[model samples]
Target chain A: MRLPSLIREVWANLLKKPATVKYPFEKLPLSKTYRGKHELMRDRCVGCGLCAKICPAFAITMRSVYGKVSPEVDLAKCIFCYQCEDVCPRGAIKRGKEYELASWSRNEMIVR
Target chain B: MEALRKAEENFVVLKAFNDLVLDVVSKDLCTKCGMCVSSCQVHAISMTDEGPKSVGPCRQCEACYYGCPRSPATSEELLKASLSSEKKDDILGSYNKIVSARTVLSEVKSVAQDGGVVTTLLIYALEEGLIDGGIVASKSTIEAWKPVPKVALSINDVLEAAGTKYSNCPSLVALKDALYGYDLSKVCVVGVPCQVTAARNVKVQPKAARKIGDKIAFIIGLFCMESFPHVKLAQFLTSNGIDIAKVSKFDIKEGKFRVYMGDAEVLSVPIRNLKDYANRFCETCRDLTSWYADVSVGAIGSGRDWSTVIVRSDEGAKLFDGAVQNGYLEVKDIESDGIESLRKIAKRKASKN
Candidate 1:
């Protein structure tokens, strides 16, 4: 709309670094609290299931883990609210900062 | 005392066993304790996911209905007849002594919920020829976790039914089988509080517990707060990651529900969270100790590995004393605090309804 402002914006872009990263070659910077694919510490999971009870997405299914039952998370349905990690008394689940999770199959996304 | 005889001497025949299914079972008053299923002489009733269902044609006999532990008609009679002491104890119905005891045998203690006193006593009874075979609630052969009633003749049979099952078992079905199929004239019956009442009914209310008649020679009752449904308990274990098929024992202690697969602990849950998985019928039950039983053995007020046995009647005392004297069990009197603990527990259970 304005010739001077348009020229100024182009001049600013030429000197500035790109906002996006070359994801495969270079890792992206993630916040400490960033929610990503979950990680389950099986040793810490006492199978109390408070997370399963409170999960709003209904993505978690309690599956038999050895002699006891533990939750199996479907990453496809997880909204990354980190509610599961928050409710876990044992701190068995955590939302990690690693977000480069591109799977070939939906079945691969299910963490048992 | 006069009212006791007058109240119980004339045992009235109810309309039908279906009346119990309608009035008690269908009304959600059924504890699913298996007294009716075990006591039914005819193959008229069977247990289902919805609870006991009337299957075959009715013969108009009220054995199943009358023998139901939760029914008012039988409950009233059982209460009067079972409480034959000079005065009610308010906590324990009728008792001669309260003691903490354990079966001395290693085989019993290995798989026991506590002292294995009940199993030891049953073994003693079988060996002493006091009983031909007894009806006991145990895990089903088909389904590992589901409870089933069986006629136990040998010590091994008794041991098979040893540990406490949180699920309600239809024990009376086996009692009927014991009387009819096995033709056992004298038999001991082990069950929870309500079940022993139903067993006593076979003695007092002849028309109701008519399937077994007066065949029950001795009764061993367990202390119970409540029992659970089979499906609910399985769901609970699955939710907790307990493989029911691998479970070797089930126990409730120190407000924790534990499932054991051999010596290895499978899963454990605090008892408070277990309420949702419980049988609806057990919620209405007020008997913690089988008040009407000959001997009530439970782990409530005892030491870590001992069971508190309440010796109620002369026959109950006889069996318990016989077991101890013959080296089947090691006995020690309960402490005042232990007795007080039992009293408080029983009082709390009675107040639930």
Candidate 2:
């Protein structure tokens, strides 16, 4: 209601940075502890299939990969709880910060 | 109408599912043998991991209460009805003959825990039309080393279910399904001592067992010192630095619990060390060899790769002799030393429990 005080408030607001960012064009940095996609170290995997056994979502399947059995994750069904990371005896499965996982086809969502 | 009212007033009050829960399940004496479930005429009882729970209204029929093996009212009568006084041994019960036997079949031997006598005898019984199916404890597909009661219809099914599971399996629960769901009129049941006692109780009980008891062709009992709770056993093994999934076989011999992965021995611990994992109900069990089973087969009092077979009933003797004569199993007399050891062990279990 005060003209000079209102003008000063407007000037201060104009100098402040916007709270929201353009997500697609200018993305914010992801936290270091973010859990998203899985990265399985094929050599470290013992072919035990413990990850598949402990997976509550039933997303991990044991499959023969390059002559050794390994876990193949279906990202479409996975809850990304990182249980595979926790239960891996050999430290084979790692959580990655790659959350942009939308795809046109379900088959493409699987991560071997 | 006056007579009917008088009769109704004089009706005797018999114990029902509630009494079973209060007397046995509540007291933690319930062995989870599935006898009560199968004994229920109205399908009121359902077997759970904890024990049998009432899923339907109780009709006060007293079938479940009387037919339960752990019931105090029926145990004495059941023993009197099922066991004979002709050749009763203090520890081994009444038996016509005892011998060390091994299966002649290579297929059975490959997978058998001991001499493959149970599998071979079941196969012979199946081929001879003695039984339409055999109730066995088969390994659960989803969980490694977990036993699930299964009705094996053929030799392959019997062989597939070979070997011993060191955990308690409520095998009698599958009796109703074997009699009705599989349409098996005559089925052989293989179980541990408590389960054998439950099966015998179901057969001897006057009222509730009439529906499913006659269908049981034979009962093959396994000698058990004690059985471990599956979850506790798994935790014990895991805590001992043994991977449950990688364990291919488990055995208790010379007072040591052994775990095997393929052909190699992975871990060994004294049986006393795993006492904490043993089912509490097993502490009350006195039978070392199934005293009431038609035939009891166990690894005790026998050489390597041989099973000690004790034939109790005439039917069991006929089956064992037939298996031997038909070249399904090879039999030899058990040594005096072996008998002495068996008696000693059985006596210890009886007195300790």
Candidate 3:
């Protein structure tokens, strides 16, 4: 409540480091258990539909590529719940430490 | 000396207590998906219409964060377009045993709506002290899929959250709520594919672990078809002069709308009216059947009262075994062909990919 004391507190905060981190470069140190952007381990992923199955939002769909593989995620509908990663027994799906997911186009958000 | 010994024991207890508290603070893994908003049995955890605000207690049932798949991770390998066939074959071949409704019924029945499978299982876990609480989906309305995540404890509370909601319910937002609002340390959750995916997404975030990690102990997944949009549904019902609010018991029988008001057939509308209400977010979906649910249940390949279930984890299998042993459910081997039919449908749906 004291003006002088408040001024001292403000001055003390000014001397401290900025709370914001410069993203995409000096990334913030994520905790050991941080769940972030999704990373697909091509080899381990059997495409069993576990991620899609576990997804509560149905944002992930299995798109058949003829005789190839099926499974595609619509980033627009994604809620990033990470149930997919936990259900992936093969460890195919894992969360990464990248949170900058903005994109100018919807197409850019879709991950193969 | 006796007093000193007692003090030492007290110190140990205090240190352990402090450690537990620190661990809770250090493991916050909230993904902000909003599933908690729909899971509350008491109609708690509502969104502020702007961002997320508040409504109720964190029943300490870790349904939201645990069910979330988007913690702080990178891309999911399942999202790739090249891993489908082999994965399907593996699931088929590895299908020696499955998690059945009968197995999960006892503990989940009274607590669950309809079949009481999921809710019962969660309750059993809590009763056995396997978990403190759970995150579950509660129906916000009969016509819409607007589910809110709720923290549940008692069986009655969980059962209140029963019934299928056909709209986009974000259970992950409850993860944030569990972290910032409630002091819950452990929880289990139930969610659909997208909400689960969000859990995975949040796993990789920097502060997610400290804010919402280690708090989730189990994830209960629900089998889902595509959900519908809200506005489109309102229009469809309005066109038919069906008072959306007064309407009770919305069901799809033979792909047709079967409306009932307290056991009385009020009106029946073509499924097409509802089909148009299907969320566009669904068509692009890859898994018509859930392959990732620790235990997934749905009516895709079975009768309405019967749910086709898939148990994918050891914990799920354990719960299934417990459910069966407890006499909450009953099951027998039908035929692998039922599962095969599901695969074919999935294939056909995937073929559009």
Candidate 4:
């Protein structure tokens, strides 16, 4: 393109709002059924280990806690699959829309 | 594998691979000590995400079954092998001598659990050529508070493996690792009550135990009340927000589970709270002082920094006397009254089960 046309394009663009959202301040709206992280209801969980069995990535391990087997999820391996939520008979774990999950240490991703 | 081939000349094998699966894996009785997996010459066993799995076309090898601490035939065989024809089974099994002993070597004392008797004896055995090496429990790197059976080849290795692991260690499984991996002709091994019983069963049935027959020279058993699996221990720690990696030592004293990080006390909780973390096999177990072991050792009814060592067999007596005579260990007669306290503790564990 010509220099004059480039100058006109830059000038016209200066009048518009910034395209990227300020993620820390202004959050974007998430879909209603968007699957992100798992939220466990400790009271509802019977530690039956069905979620661990259905996990395709083998991301979940059943740990024995207080005489019952409990689910421990590694968020790093989770492909945002909602199969755990679908398979859970007790509804102990459900997919929630909180996609901002990032970590410096992989250990922080484990939800026991 | 060659031994099994030689044994094939004698008799037909029955219920070898299936027995291990049915008796241990299915019942959740198998301790993930990796013994059965290591003992499998044909590579018939593997530890899976679920637990120890015996994948097929099995050679019908009975090593996995015999090496299992929770196997069905072990108890009856342990009775015959450990006890003589006349001596009846008791809560505190056969013993030639009982004493409170400690390592005279300061190096041994520095890292020793209790009196460091197990470490001291192993060091003596290695130096004197009584055994080629020793097998003891070491912590698993993947998870804290979990134990793996390790073959300690030097004094440094034995000292490093000192202290109670507070979890199930299939230490007898490493007997195979010691012979094959390290190429030791004879070795001593340390284990808990259930594992001692497995070792004794091996001593009785040479055909089933295979090359394990003459490989194990001595057995040092710990007085176990109960032990937990790795998951349960991790869970218990998580509930208290206590990090397992930071723990340096663990001891059961005066009805408490004491955890130490260096000199500082990390956590001290009642033994009752840990019952839930305990394995199901421990619930039915009757042995407390390792009735079947050649020598059983514990801190019960002994002074601080002393171990209550019960020499149960002539082999045990030989080791104890030799270690004492060599000035590696100092011994004092365990008080007659102290014997009563030990008996009471043993009976409590039996009744609880």
What C-alpha lDDT, on a 0 to 100 scale, does residue B168 get in candidate 4? 79
- Candidate 3: tens digits of C-alpha lDDT, residues A4-103: 9999999999998999988767876779777667787654443445567657889788665643344576767878887766544334566787767788
Error of 3 at B350 (Å): 3.2
The predicted structure with the larger DockQ, 1 or 3, is: 3
Residue B156 in model 2: lDDT? 88
Candidate 4 residues B1-353, lDDT tens each?
99898777745446566777887778877655565665565556777545677664565545667656677755564455555423444768877778999998888888778898988999999899899888899767787767777888888888878878887766765776777667787888788887777666556543344346456788889988898877788778878887888887888888899888889988899999888889877887888998877888999988888999988788888888899999989999897777899889899988887
Clashing pairs in 4: B35-B173
Instruction: Pick out the ten consecutive residues of candidate 4 chain B with the lowest summed lDDT.
Output: B205-214
True contacts kept of each: 0.00, 0.00, 0.00, 0.00
Off by over 4 Å in 3: A1-112, B1-74, B78-96, B103-114, B141-146, B200-213, B253-257, B264-275
User: B66-171, model 2: which lDDT tens digit per residue?
Assistant: 6777888765555655755367786898888889999999999889988999999999999999999998999999988889988899888898899999999888
Q: List the residue pairs that clash in candidate 2.
A: none
**Candidate whose lDDT is highest:** 2
Candidate 4: which stretches are off by over 4 Å? A1-112, B1-13, B32-35, B48-50, B75-78, B81-89
lDDT, candidate 1, A10-37, per-residue tens:
9999989999889789986788779888
Q: List the DockQ of the predictions in order.
A: 0.00, 0.01, 0.01, 0.01
Q: How is the predicted docking of candidate 4 categorized under the CAPRI scheme?
A: incorrect
lDDT of 2: 0.84
Question: For model 4, what is the alpha-carbon lDDT of residue B282?
Answer: 84
The DockQ-derived docking category for candidate 3 is: incorrect
Candidate 2 CAPRI assessment class: incorrect
